[model samples]
Target chain A: MRAFVRALPWIGPALVLIALVVLFPIGVMIGNSTRDISQSGVDRGGVGLANYAEVFAFPYFWPIVGRTLVWVVVVVVLTVVISLALAQLLDKAFPGRRLVRMAVVVPWAASVVMTTLVVHYGLEPYFGIINAFLVDTGIISRPEGFGWTRNPGTAFAWAIVVAVFVSLPFTTYTILAGLQTVPGETLEAARIDGAGPLRAYFGVVLPQLRSALAVAVLINVINVFNSLPILRVMTGSIPGYDADTVMTMIFKYMQNQHRIDLASALSVVAFGLVVAIVGVYLRVVRPLEEA
Target chain B: MRHTRRASGIIAITLATTTGLTACGFGGGTDEGDGGEGTTLDLLVPSYSDATQANWEGVIAGFEEANPEITVNLEVESWDNLESVIATKIQGGQAPDIYNGGPFAGFAADELLYPVEDVTSDATYADFQESFLSNAEVDGVAYGLPFIASARALFVNDALLAQAGAEVPTTWDGLLESAKKVSALGGGIAGYGMPLGSEEAQAEAAVWLWGGGGSFGDADAITIDTPENLAGAEFIQKMVTEGATQADAGSTDRSPLMDIFIQGQIGMQVGLPPTVGQIEENNPELEYSIHPIPTQDGSPFTLGVADHLMAFENDGDKQEAITAFFDYFYTSDVYVPWVQAEGFLPTTKSGAEVLGDEESLAPFLAVLPDAQFYPSTNPSWSTADSAFKALFGQLATGKTAADVLTEIQSQVDAG
Candidate 1:
């Protein structure tokens, strides 16, 4: 007790914050998941993980889990790849670079809900500008334009597009910061050795952005996994389980007259998946400490 | 510099300690609110647009004038946001004394309701529409007062009907025939507008199901696949097969369906009275007619949804304050104009009697007393509704109606 008390001045605030902010809500969630929650969201009492059993037993549960996994992977991979390209392009000296970078950042600055609404309208089949433009350009017929939101495949595709749109800037900026740290002298040395621009970027600079890329990809994975706005708004809350990710399902479970206990169980599982991914990432990254 | 840093550290520790204790208390149990000289009632109302909020303020001011000793704190939550907000508040044990909501069964089951007799006058309780009261009842105990009601009816486009040379359809066969004629117009017109999507699958399906003498699950169960309900689902499929409704009706929504109707792209659709205002606002030249949803035997039946005012019990003084305010607001002079200003139907039989000759609402008002509501009584109905919504579009696919219905049943059972 004396030794712990002596250390309190240095570590007390963090321990107190974690106890109140993190552990309390987590405790509440696990406690509620063991109980029956009324539609009004009051926990009636413990039922010993019956909520978890029920949620897992749903016919679509595993499929939804698989879909969520696929969504996070696809969205995060696409975001990182595109953002890396943009970051490399922006890092090069060019006229009108600031304007292009600002344009890239606009989607990231937009309100996610508003971006979802704009994307929804832009993708509307009959009266949308995208369809009109595509039709006028003779790229697609009117019938092709009218059903993107209705079809699961196209709807999921568009959801990824919007997700990537809003996620681009932060990833780009993160990579650009990493690129800045890649010494100009190193690029100069590569060029002195007859290395072309692409070769220098690939062989010399790209390897140095490993940590930034890893951090960016990890955050994108977690964020895309929890994203609900794109799917919710574009589908108008109708995208069936075939197209829905786990986050949207959790939202559906949390609506009026909701199954909050089950939502809690699902949430705990989602958190566990995120933690597992991070754990795997850290294990892979553990080798980087010596570098 | 070391002394200044130490002082800053001390201040930071003090702030963190204070915040930690407060947060811990909030995370656990907040002390009961007690600040007023007399009683304070916090009322959580569904968010209102400007006109409706003004009317509510006027009524609240009048009540406050009549009872100065009691204070009412009106917290208006957005309709889309109220669900999560109330759930958080209720679960946190800080539920408002009165809240605006429908589907009160969960609250009633949780034993959270303050009960109507506790917060309503004897006269108002006796005079309310019994269906409104009974629908708000759980196990023979009334827990809510019906505040607004809506009923669905068929809306027809006059230009399309005239072009197709068809009259307003009152029978299912007649409706299908009209839809076929409209589709046969062949200019990219939806024969009929169908909203078999998630946002309102139950609302969309209810008109057909109820008209066919089917019902959603009663007090104890969910009835998704009864023969009558299945027949209704089959009829919807038939409408799609015959090109009497949009081929992509499963992907459509109420707004788009209504928009196409107003634009004369669809011949007929199911709608409430406000559809008139919406259409009139969008296209003044469009002519339309309203009637009851068609039935196999040409019977008069319609689907309705309602919202209610509920009081959560905390103390006798708060309950008494709520009762006093409710009695003041229930008068014909106050409520009738409110019903008129907002286009919602009357909630009380006496309010309907007062509006007997109001021609504008006659079509909807005629069916108000007998209108059936969504089966919100099942504490699990909300969960089931989402599953049903997700499965509704499967009717347009290879899945059988029984499969879709059973999918919903299985989810509800599992949930």
Candidate 2:
């Protein structure tokens, strides 16, 4: 008790900040999920679990949930795999390596909304620059038919590509840092033992990268799952939640439906689902980490 | 001990500055609330064009010059962000004194607005078009002041029609035939620009559904699944399936499609009066003619849309200042120029008389009398509007008219 009391002041400000910034909003969100909030956001008293019931009963709820899972998995998996290769390349000594490294940060340094907007207009069916280029190069027959972000199927695919694009720099940098810490002697040892370069990388360096990979994967999963601006700008005008994740769907509830209570309810469910997903991922990753 | 004393001094200074800043914030709030010689009002409006902010600022300049005691703070938001911005402000207890937006029945239902009479003089209120004023009524009491009115008309590319050897269409069958011919010309040109996307699908739905003698019912009910409405939806699906519309019509929004039309890539589209200005600015050489929107039975039809300016029930002190602002804004000298600049029809009698002579405004003006409106006075109208925006695009994705309408009907019913 005395030790904890002595430590209190050092941690007190951080505790207050978490309470104010994080815990308070969560408490309010859970409270709002139960309340009968008006479209204009007037709190009309509590309705118990009725708002949650309505959210469950929403017609597109399950489909959107399924799409969200696919969205997170595809984007995060692609990001990690591509990032691993890029990190290895970036770690090697090369001429103008620093310049190339700076160039890689462009997508990350630029605003996500601005990046998505550029892609959105670039894929316009008529007169888009990218569409024109494809037509000119004989890659596409014409510039009028390829509305890449308009159809749900193609829109979802393009959104995944963009999600991976913006996710690369931070992820690559993380793994690259992990690569720097791997001892050169170890790779030399594996090479002397008659292991091929590929075999040495997979068997030796990869295991040392386990913690960094874990951190990268976990953060990417959450960030990709909760990503809004890419999908919002890409498929926002496309009607229906056919391509929506829970984050965008929750925005629809508030922006389109004007039902704050329902949005709050769905938010709670989304929060729970994210926690469960991350928990399961951690449980699986922990055993691997231990090994 | 000396280092500890220095830390305590820094903390003392920080606490003092924080308290000082908090007091200044409170002081500013009270000054805004005080009903003395000088008063400030908040005005929130959506950007109609690049000129929207300038026009409002001009009005404020004139109003303030005339009435030196009242000051107005203006916030201009894009049409895309206006609703959510207003909602956020209201929820945060910082609703603007006056907000210009589309649907106010939701706000009116919540008793968040002052009645029209409370915010405008009797003469100012009497000057408004009776039809528009009635459109703003909720429970037989007006809540919104109609700020701008627009009626939709069919804009046909004269060059495209001539090239295709098709005359301008008057009926639905004639339109389909004309569109097919235009599409047949085939150098990346669309016969018709069908925008069933979320941006303004409700407007396009209004054009077809109303032309087919259907209504979106009223506050208490949704009539979207009616056979008349179904016929309209089927016609849209027919247009999509027959390759008459641009590809991926489901996700094409009005603005980008309008850009295509301006570029002379689209043959026909339903357009507003402002579309003429856009065409003039972007591609003045493109020959186009405006006509009455084609109907199933060949009767005259047009979709009328209006955005309203409403006063939130702010503190009691703002009522007089708001009325003064409204009266100043509606005066013919001030209102007509702004209307002309924005290229929208005026909601006041005198402003219309002044703008009536302009050639481009004549076609839209002639059809204003027969224009059908979305049931915006209905509290459920926003819900129904959003439903159309989100679901009508499904028709392009091979969802049947009946299925889409049934889904929309259920959404409205649930609301």
Candidate 3:
């Protein structure tokens, strides 16, 4: 108690910073979610949870929620699986491995919006490189009148692919760091105990990556769930919310609908969903960590 | 003790930060004041062309030379972001002293703007065309000053029409038949450039719905699901199903489709004045003619669009400076050049008399008398306009015209 008292000044600023930056905004968002905000953003008096009710009553709400789930699950799963394989391969110390690893960071290092825009333009029907190549190779003919992102389904699929592409570097690096910590002696011991290479890896190395995998999965789940740029740039202009995720829907509610109150309500609902999903994940992972 | 000195040091740092922050707050407040030092006005306007900022800056230079006590800070934003930028600025309590954009009803409804009479010289207020001035009124009180105007007319690709053995369409049925004939030419060519996409679907909606003898309702009510409006929407769906428009008309935007039309691939489209400049710059060889947009009964229909400049009631003290700025801006010497440079129809009578003789702008001006506008005076028009932009494209997809119109009607009703 005495030491904590003495340390208060040192930590006080950090606590104040957190309160101002994080807690204050959350409080304000919750308050605004209950208020009636005009299109010009004038705040009318509180309306309880009417904004939330409006959000739930929105025609596209359920579909957007479903798509958001699919987005988070598919992107995170692909990212984790691909990163695992890439990490395993990199651990073998191949030539040009340093250069390849640096190259892996390009999509992650570049601005997500910029990268998505390049991909978006590259898929344009008129002069896009991809469409040109496809036509040249006789894969698609010009008479078909098709663009790569013409359909919402195809556009959402491409957005997921881009999401996985950008998510690879961080997940791979985390898993690679975990792989390095697994001592070589343990793998040799497992091999000497009559296990095959695959068996040795699954038995010896996989269990040691548990904590790192947890961190990667948790972070990727949150990041992919909250991602806006890939979905926005890839399929934002498509008429309906058929390809929309919750993050993009929140943006559309404010931008297209001019319903700031609705956006805030959706934001709070999204916040709660993230917390619940992360809680479940932690509960499932904590026992394994202890073991 | 060392602990006592450390605690004292921390307290001193906190005191210094609080004082510094408070000082900044006071500094910002004073800067916004119209003191003897000078009155600084923040003018936020949308970019009409690449030269938009330079033109405004030139006006400011002259205005400042004439009135040395007023300083105008200019911020130019793209038309796509202008609405949200103004909204954000208003929400942040930093609304500009003057703003140039469309849809002033929401601001006027909130009493965030000074009425036109308060912010403009009496002469300048009287200078606006009667029709245009009345269009800016909300509940019989004007809030917006007409800044620029453009009217839509049918742009026919003469070469394409001739190749397809079609003439310039004068009625709805004639339009469909002509578009079909052009589409039959094949080779990745769209018959009619129909852009019902997110960018500016409302403009296309106005052209068709109004042409079909439907209205988007008056200020008191909004009626989107009328039979005439349905006919208009069904025409778009027909265009899509018959392969008269480009692929994915649901997602295609206006600017790019306009580019295709400029490339001489489209037979006909409704276009604005700036499209003339675009064709000149990109494809001067593409022969085209401007005609009245086809109506169901062969009556003249042109979708008139105008952007307005409005003054905010910020501190209720910058009125004099804003008035001076408006008077200076609306002067013929200052206004005519800006209008000519941007290639838009002038909204004032004097400015019109000067530019009505320009060859390229004459056709649009000829159609201006029959012009109709979106119900921008209604506070709910912004909501309806957005609904049109976001949902109108669904007609090209699988959504029925009736359903889409009903959905838009419900949105407007909810508002």
Report the number of backbone clashes for model 2. Answer: 0
lDDT of 2 at A55: 89
Across residues B1-415, which tens digit of lDDT does each residue of candidate 1 receive? 7545643443343333222211221223545556767677787888545576777787788878889987777777777777777877887878888888866777888788888887888898887888877887777788878888889888888888899888798888999999999888865677788888766777877877777778888767877878878887888888888889875677777767688788878899998767777777788888778888898789888887888888887544576778888898888888888777777788887888888787767888887656888777666666666666767767765577788777777767766
Q: Rate the local accuracy (lDDT) of all candidates.
A: 0.76, 0.86, 0.84
Give per-residue lDDT, candidate 2, residue A100: 93
Q: What global local distance difference test value does model 2 have? A: 0.86
What range of 10 consecutive residues in model 3 chain B has the weakest lDDT sum? Answer: B21-30
Ranking of predictions according to DockQ: 2, 1, 3
Off by over 4 Å in 1: A1-15, A137-145, A284-287, B1-34, B48-50, B376-380
Q: Which whole-number lDDT from 0 to 100 does residue B3 have in model 3?
A: 41
- What would you estimate as the lDDT of candidate 1? 0.76
Clash pairs (backbone) in predicted model 1? none
lDDT (Cα, tens digit) per residue for candidate 3, span A1-291: 999989999999987975664555666677778999898878888999999998999888998888888998899999999999999998888899999889988988999998888888888877677777787888887853356676789999999989999999999999999999999899889878999988988888888898788778877887887777798888866887788888888777777777778878888888767667666776666623434
Worst 10 residues of 2 chain B by lDDT: B21-30
Interface RMSD (Å) of model 3? 9.1
Q: Candidate 3: misplaced stretches above 4 Å?
A: A285-288, B1-36
The backbone clash count of each candidate, in order, is: 0, 0, 0
- Superposition error at B103 for model 2 (Å): 0.5
**Highest-scoring model, DockQ:** 2
